[model samples]
Target: MSRIRPQVRISRRLSTTAGVAVTTATLLTAALSPAAHADTRPSRATAIENAAAALLAHAASLGLTSAENTSVRDVIVDKDGTQHVRYDRTYHQLPVLGGDFVVHLAPDGAYRSADRSTRAPISLASIVPKIASPEAAGLAVNALRAANLGTVLKQVKAKPELIVDALHGTPRLAWRTNAVGLDSLGNPVARTVLTDARTGAQIDAWDSIETAAGDGKSLYSGTVPLQTTPSGSSYQLKDPTRGNTYTGDAQGQTDACILSICISRAPAVLFTDADNHWGSGTTADRASAAVDAQYGTDETWDYYKNVQGRNGIGGDGKGSYNRVHYGSNYNNAFWDDSCFCMTYGDGDGTTFGPLVALDVAGHEMTHGVTSKTAALTYSGESGGLNEATSDVLGTLVEWYANNPSDPGDYLIGEKIVKPGFGHTALRYMDKPSKDGSSADYWSSSVGNLDVHYSSGVANHFAYLLAEGSGPKTINGVSYDSPTYNGSTITGIGRDKLGKIWYRALTVYMTSSTNYKGARTATLNAAKDLYGAGSTEYDTVAAAWSAVNVN
Candidate 1:
């Protein structure tokens, strides 16, 4: 989840790409249990109309102009009668980049609050571009080459779209062009170059492709039930039961990426077999890794669906795909948003075994969830928070699975690490500094460190929040968490902690949320769930302070 600003190293891939993919057999074709609600609304259209009218009447409250047209994207009314209405905006008939906003209304149909991607208004100077589209495409291509990226320029498509500048300086008109190609590493790359329409000068550019996804006898998680779809004489890996979660074999190649691999040469073919029984527990069989990836994905899906009330990784009832045995002896795994899929590596046995372990899958899948929700940028303190979120959720998934062979613990990647390393795990939450690189306390220069290491502060904060600041044993593992301050604090329990963190991540936290902002977000979440000034809120504040985030 965290990477240094520029370089794309292998170690960075491991921390940033771990996640789960899920699958099901014919038996799991049942409908998902609908969330229980108390009150009923008149109709979806009526609710949308009511919310839209309210938003239009109070446009200034949301920093919107009267000229902007707002269209309802989706509306969700909670069991408590709270309505969350999401809308897309267009300025003077042109799409606005950061104009999306969500309006929350209380049961009384009164405005509660709103969440906007950008606080700046959308009124720009003009829609006409000073530079032509062809020249803009050339500018984007030149900018890509100027970055010294060890990749070739391929099909570059430049289209002019009117956008308001909110991230950098004052609001201004810009031409946004997206150039799609492949990096030197064979990874699919897309760069959105924002050029000043008045001057044709490049404002900014970022790598469009970012890695971010899950079922079944799973090779590592033991024999498990899977939902499958019948297709003539054979069955497909598709799981009608769990949002059509499917599996595909990369066969150690990138171009064959299915639902979840980025920059694949061709579409991934579903792994079909005469019998639905897939994989023996060894690498000699190709399906074994798919079994592991799918099983882990299923468990993670169930954990979020049953425990946290999330439908899928994106909170929508759509399943992501998984690819196994990707690249020959690849030493790492990753989740790419471009393909909406999860990819696995069969590690060189001497340094690491197969990377499809339960926690590893959970870690990577949670990355997708993070991108959809808080969307913490993969740099600075926010990046650290992104990685920490995966670690926390991944650990929870492991505990939820309750697998006998891989019992739950705060330790990560313990089973996958080779014996030659003498390392018990990749990182420890209770005492993260044990890794020698991770930081256990927040500091002024904390964001300067690698995102994975900087995440230790949040990881340490989570440990103290759930288990307190003292020596303890859990699930056969011993841990003694230290605090930046010498204050003794009591834990609020993992269940409550998980609820608070999930709420903060989904509702309160933003893309650029830092350590201090996180403390406030969790505190706000705790207050919302357990009442203001309650013991839970106090504990959240105390835990954050213990991590030197105050």
Candidate 2:
């Protein structure tokens, strides 16, 4: 793309750490053990009912009751049968901001504790806003302008919602305004501005759009099947069979942003060709990149649905479109949650060519999955995990595709690496430290490093968990993974690794989960998928320990 979307784009940074040595004997001794019994439990419905009843019994003390019009938002069950039920409340039929809480339940369905986002109850004098809705919208736009986001073109929809502000200060009524448009790069833009209805003071503002910028191929992925729609005269790039996922051409303009708010993007005109067959497998042809972008989108959609049981990126079975040939020789790709689309860049042709490589495609799209679920904050250890999640799934997608042209391996961005980049890939899971910056083992300061580098800890852990620590070859790729405690970990196979990680991501992880939280999350995931004392569970524990995540 002409301008890279800055918010969620993955940045590759290189830094080094002195390897903290540990003895093999110590590692084996430090390995994690099963924490609970694996006996069969009650049916899901029964367990949920018991947990709900337990929470209701303590509702009064927790500032919740039937009169508050609170309803369960989600119910999460951990491996130890602990239930975490998140509830959303409404005050006088109006949604209450900060009126959400998670009720923790013991394995026996007893109330253990409750974590409330808001400290105080949803007690408000009036739910009505003193400021008019139009005036609230104006305040939001002004706030956006104050934040250097002056253009507010696309005005998707603006509405006022009531929320309580007890967490930050004294409880009071507020209005939350959601505005979406386009940015300067034609990528989607959005902001949720919270204003004090009593005084019209801007309380908070956050970008609604989660972005990470993308693709082509014929240049990357080899000849592949594409789903197309016939538009009377010619076929369009839209895929009707796959939730109508389509590919549009930016035509290198980068100024098609509309709605005044949308970023200045190349016009997203649907890609159409006279012949059904597209692309020449070279950057000289525009369809080449479009072909790669479209193919990648299809593969990613299928991978999530068929492998992970996810219907779509948002798990809603809705097809998202792709923008190809974005900007002139842009060197990055990103995913925009606001637009629900993936954008790809044509590589500068030096260090990179077209970025629509198979794994990269999967890597970018998994960001959306991360956004929809867990919603990991893009900083610190959580950010590292976020990037690692994408890398892990992206590698799996490549493996799932089983493309001969680009075989699946622990190497990322392998196909796009420049000759003089020194390393063959962007990051190496087998030996992440080989990237010159990634951490092979976790440390207290790991979170302080660049997320891309911090992800090395998890990447190395995944490699050991899946293929073990040793020198080996798979699909012509060789990997030798090292551990923190200098221990040898046996392989659990990639399929099991994928299952455990996916489960943890969708079920146990939260926005603020850290490295320690990740260990618990995966352990719980493994226990839930396998038995508590099962080999998978032990392997997960062992893997985390090997990476110094314990």
Candidate that scores best on lDDT: 2
On residues 1-550, what C-alpha lDDT tens digit does candidate 1 reach at each position? 1121111100011111112111111111111236466336434444454565566557677876655666554455555566666555567666565565667777667778877757876666677777887888788777766654555654444444666555444666777776665444443344567888789888767544433211245556676666677788877877776778887887666543222223345345577756888777777877777778778788888988888777887666789988777665655667766566777767768767778888888888888877665667666687789888888888889988898878888987786778764667878999888978899999999988767788899999998998899998888899999888898988888888788887777766666678987898899789878999999999999998998988
TM-score of each: 0.79, 0.71
lDDT of 1 at 307: 80
Q: lDDT per residue, candidate 2, 184-249, as tens digits?
A: 444344566888988999876654433323123488777888879989988898889888999888
After superposition on all C-alphas, the RMSD of every candidate to the true structure, in Å, is 8.7, 11.8
> What number of clashing residue pairs does each candidate have, in the order they appear?
26, 39
Q: lDDT score of model 1?
A: 0.69
- The alpha-carbon lDDT assigned to residue 69 of candidate 1 equals 60
